[model samples]
Target: MDTGVPLSVAVSVVGKRQNPELVRVAGAGKEKCCYFFWQGRNSTVSEKGTSALMTVELDEERGAQVQVQQGKEPPCFLQCFNGGMIVHSGRREEEEENAQNEWRLYCVRGEVPVEGHLLEVACHCSSLRSRASMILLSVNRAIIYLWHGCKAQPHTRDVGRTAACRIKEQ
Candidate 1:
């Protein structure tokens, strides 16, 4: 979500995909029932409505092992909604700077000619390799480029097309 926009904007945008009644009531502000988890503390929608989107970095070695987190303070705020409740606090996780980039690259992996399997790669020329497929998204230019190395696997074109479609929908 763009911090430049108001929280109300989020409500409106979400209304496009959420329950009509919920969105309408929230917008009307008659009896606001917005609630969600923030950090590790309890938070409410009536709060200052200041938040930022951040990416929590996990160890590559451990892959994606879940860990319990206690409360801490001093970090950017982001409206986080994964599952369960919303808790608001001053706590912040590590920011994923790269996630903020308007340009993104994804390397297509797997040898089965999958339609959407991809591994996100840094948007650098060095990241391009000969044995795989890739997708490049340029939001500023409103363009999507698909590249396939000559020695790439069989599904590069299919995966690129499917992934590009998904990105467009997003």
Candidate 2:
């Protein structure tokens, strides 16, 4: 999957005559996975809120694979209902130096909620170990804030907790 895509948008799936409708909530630019919203009644409701009842096919694929650098930190804070694990990390000086543009690794698995809205956030870390170190930081400080649509900005003081670790591995 292409890493440039965002996976933070909400999408609605409509059922055709032969096909069932499905709703997809995913992060911007990332591949969306199919999540069954509501089962269909004998009759379909009007488009107003009826769109929420559309049935979806279980075989369909949605979000894309999030790409992270091997040995580098991820660029944005990652969130998913199911817990995720760190997979890789890397560094590219040629790329932008901001935290949002840095690279990292993660593997998330869980049932995404379809009640109100779903959101996926991307986070950046300066180093690999620190990236893992900041998992709790991303969850409590970043992910929670984004999920609730809260307004607090991330603090810069929290960035260097893992700085004492070695830079390069043998």
Candidate 3:
């Protein structure tokens, strides 16, 4: 499948007490296919942290969506296509502080036919403040890809009098 074209993107962040979530949305039009690569990192004062990378494929014509959520309490949830979900737990904490720092990455590839098209992606990081102290979070980065069709190849030119020119030079 074609990787599609890349476009400019915008990033936003929202922080909440008791419940914290991160959301990202991107897509092409309904007439093509696209793909995306995502990466994420979580940092805190205690020296503990987490990181992940994911890739996704999207079909603009069929309206496909992929959702991923990672946290300490409820584990991680990965949803794709229609009613598909995958759950994973026991992610190794890099340091003592990492147990409180939660992070996840989402990458998608697909096509969108509309110029003003949009997609929604969200992440939530939650843990017991009693067991592990939640420190100041330094979450950053969002990469968006916009499909702009395929690229064209270079053209070649032929010389009609190559043989005559070659003999004269020799």
The alpha-carbon deviation from the true structure for residue 125 of candidate 1, after best TM-score superposition, in angstroms, is 0.9
Candidate 1 lDDT, 65-157, residue by residue in tens: 221121331111121211111221122332354436677677764333331345556689999998767778777778888888888766666
TM-score (C-alpha) between model 1 and the true structure: 0.39
> Residue 88, candidate 2: how far off, in angstroms?
11
Stretches of model 2 off by over 4 angstroms after superposition: 1-60, 77-157, 161-170
What candidate 3 gets wrong by more than 4 Å, as runs, is: 1-30, 36-79, 91-170
Q: Residues 1-170, candidate 3, lDDT per residue (tens digit)?
A: 01111111222323333422222232221243222222112323222211111122233333322222222111111111211211212223433455454443221111211111112122333321222111122233222222211231111001112211222333
Question: For each predicted model, how many residue pairs clash, with residues at least 3 apart or on different chains?
Answer: 10, 36, 20
- RMSD value for candidate 1: 15.2
TM-score of each: 0.39, 0.17, 0.17
- Candidates 1 and 3: which is better by lDDT? 1
Give the C-alpha miss distance for residue 19 in model 2, angstroms: 32
Model 3, poorest ten-residue lDDT window? 152-161
Better candidate by lDDT, 1 or 2? 1
Tens-digit lDDT track of model 2 for 1-170: 11211233233444334323322333123333533232122212353133332222222464323332222223232232112322222223323454564333232212221111111124533322321222222322332111111221232112212111111110
Local accuracy by lDDT, each model: 0.44, 0.26, 0.22
Indicate which candidate wins on lDDT.
Answer: 1
Candidate 2 local accuracy as lDDT? 0.26
